[model samples]
Target: MSRKASGFTLIELMITVAIVAILAAVALPSYRSYVTRGRIPEATTALASKRVQMEQFYQDNRTYVDAPAGNNDTGTSTYFDFTAAPGGAETRTATGYVLSAVGKNGMTGFTFTVDQSNAKRTVVSGVPGWTDTTVNCWLTKQATSC
Candidate 1:
């Protein structure tokens, strides 16, 4: 009596592995880009909200200097570090301010900045396919306009 193989043959298994590898090769970068894009709102929202607070503080104190320090909504961000420009310069008090979010961890190589003028800019250097210029453009994975 002859019996048929009950399981996949070596060639069939190899083909399956190859298909999975190909799929992963296509999907992985896309997934990373999506994740990076997701992290951007954390920066933009925080900066915008801080801008409001700074404006309020200016209304009360008549200057941008010594405005209350802004905190990251989560206390600690996973992908970026938020900072206010003109930080702690006792000799000079800023009439205008720039808030920035610098990428961290796996998100390193990008920086987003917003100023009192409400201008937005991105600086991308270490990331591939982007130049080092700090261009006035919205931050995106495509690095378009910059």
Candidate 2:
């Protein structure tokens, strides 16, 4: 025998590239979902803190109407837009109110709500690979209700 080729053939290189592509295709979505879930706690924590603030205001005013206008943000978030609910300047009723967080940036298709009754819920999502239970619960994990 003379000598074997020391370098990879064109076909071998193409096969390696194809394998990498398949791995990436499978991994990218899982990594993206994990990142999304990480950002979600920010919204929930802000909402909880805002709820406490609302309760304090209610204790003093005895009505949710004076709590905060709908345009006033409960708190700041980079990945979420916090609105007092209804996303307008209208005031809520004296006995009840709702606060919601809408996703921003790369977090579209996510909406979370909390009410004066402390009810937490995640709206049905339109995102691919996400399954919303629509059961009046927050989804802290992938397709899992909280």
Best-fitting candidate, measured by lDDT? 2
Give the per-residue lDDT of model 1 (tens digit) for 93-113: 557777778888877888887
Best of the candidates, TM-score: 1
Please provide TM-scores, in order, for all candidate models, with all chains considered together. 0.84, 0.83
Candidate 2's TM-score? 0.83
Error of 1 at 79 (Å): 1.8
Instruction: Please give, for residues 7-76, the per-residue lDDT of candidate 2 as tens digits.
Output: 9999999999999999999999999889988988998888888788888888998877766533566346
Pairs that collide, model 1: none
Regions of model 2 farther than 4 Å from truth: 1-5, 68-71, 87-91
> Model 2 RMSD to the real structure?
2.7
Clashes of each: 0, 0
Residue 67 shift from truth in candidate 2, angstroms:
2.3
